[model samples]
Target: MLRITAGKLAGAMRGALVGNSTRVAAVRSLHGTEESAEEFDKRYEKYFSREGIDGWEIRKGMNDLLGMDLVPSPKIVEAGLRAARRVNDIALAIRWLEGCKYKCGDQMATLYPYILEKVTPTLKELGVPTLEELGYDKPELALKSVYDQ
Candidate 1:
């Protein structure tokens, strides 16, 4: 099960919803899956549309749960990474990293580890740091430098 650290239940719910979406997508792509493609599409479409629920309302709820007075992309990325790690799913991690790359920028470096480590070693050869960098060598201070500017 995925765990969310955000104070609000809505944030947790959103995280779970997103994680489930990812899992469903992965399962459908597996070879010789038991679920029919049509069935998988129907289920995913229902969740994607937020049918009975208001999509904007859920977005608002997530905003409130974040409590940072801004849409916290970092928090979302952290949650996704944690969920992927919890499931021991590298593909999920790659998906989450791709999403982060889209949001943060392709050259952001931090979001490219999945590609670098698994797909290619060029980044490591170039001396790029992985997410582990955020946990080492005065990370809080380094992060503050980015956020403070």
Candidate 2:
């Protein structure tokens, strides 16, 4: 079943009137085949928008990308890239990276470079020193240093 956490729903809801929105809840499908990413997002917003549904138990899960078994799916990586390009929100990019790092575990190495490349400009805009500025001659070393921090 496709499930979504209330926190992710709230993030999607953005400026909606999410009273006590910090709480997390998981909504799952009872039956029927999993929906497409677009359809799932539509349904998730619809379910979360309804009145009530607060203080529910928060289960670990991801949003959209039904076919994906991995945490840092291409959709998520793209979303982070888009955020970096448009909003340039360092916190958002970092949160995405942290989520992937925490959930993807050893698999994160494969995706880390792509994420770092996408977010580097935003990080620079946010005054985070680059690898060159930090005296790291190599991007991989700089990535490790930044990841460690």
Candidate 3:
């Protein structure tokens, strides 16, 4: 399950990663309001039932992963797949992985091949950019700090 995997991944990366768990807060900010678990679930189900999800949804999910500030592991991917399978929505799962890629940035480089293999066809049909195409195939290490004077 995603919860289990997320927990383990978080545990493994707690000291190694650099982001914060701001999804809950970010969600509330993005929505301009707080939502209860049931409310969120209802909204999520409705969103998933649509023919397609928008970039905002994907970005929000990515922000959540970014908040964790950890690189993704294979187990994390498996957990996401399992969670999506529970809903019988393969596209949604792929979308979630896309979000993971954006959220984790270079940290997801190792996952690009696996993710591409799984979602290439669907993404082509859907006209979504592959992670590699989007320039996520490698880490983007800055040569200079933004604060450099």
Candidate 4:
């Protein structure tokens, strides 16, 4: 039987509400490292199994979110940043920044500054260039820059 570790039904619901097909495809693309289809299925199965939710429901929810054709709001981006900060997870912080770049183009100029302020120290500690230096023009490129650095 599946069990939800997060105990946050709202998170799952929100995920469903925002998980559109496009976003799902984007997420899949984000998993760029080569992995077999079986591996991907296993990973998703584990995710759904742990969430105590039906896989189809989750996929449907993702599709619904994608249909909205909206990027994540600033509020969501801020929340993700806060979470990353709290966890001291640089990779997660970078991921959130990348998401903000993808979804909030209007706020890109402002967002980059904010992310730089928060992530710069971490990046320096990890011997990576600032987001501005690496250039946040492309999410995939930014991710690679971070990974390569």
Query: What lDDT does the true structure give each of the candidates?
Result: 0.45, 0.46, 0.55, 0.51
State the lDDT of candidate 2 residue by residue for 25-103, as single tens digits: 2223434577687765455444433344331210112233222565544444544434333444444444444555456
lDDT of 1: 0.45
Can you give the TM-score per candidate against the true fold? Answer: 0.25, 0.32, 0.32, 0.31
Cα distance off (Å), candidate 1, residue 85 = 1.0
For candidate 3, write residues 51-97 as lDDT tens digits: 54454554454345446645444344444444454455656565666
TM-score of 2: 0.32
Per-residue lDDT of 21 in model 3: 56
Runs in model 1 deviating more than 4 A are: 1-72, 105-149
Give the worst 10-residue stretch by lDDT in candidate 3: 72-81
Per-prediction CA RMSD (Å): 19.2, 17.5, 17.6, 20.8
Report the Cα lDDT for residue 118, model 3: 65
Off by more than 4 A, model 4? 1-68, 105-130, 136-149
The sequence of per-residue lDDT tens digits that candidate 4 reaches over residues 12-97 is 87778787866888988888689665664455334433433443444443344324545544333443444444445556556555
Q: What is the clash tally of candidate 3? A: 1
Worst 10 residues of 2 by lDDT: 54-63
Candidates sorted by TM-score, best first = 2, 3, 4, 1
Please report the TM-score between candidate 3 and the true structure: 0.32
- Evaluate model 3: give its lDDT: 0.55
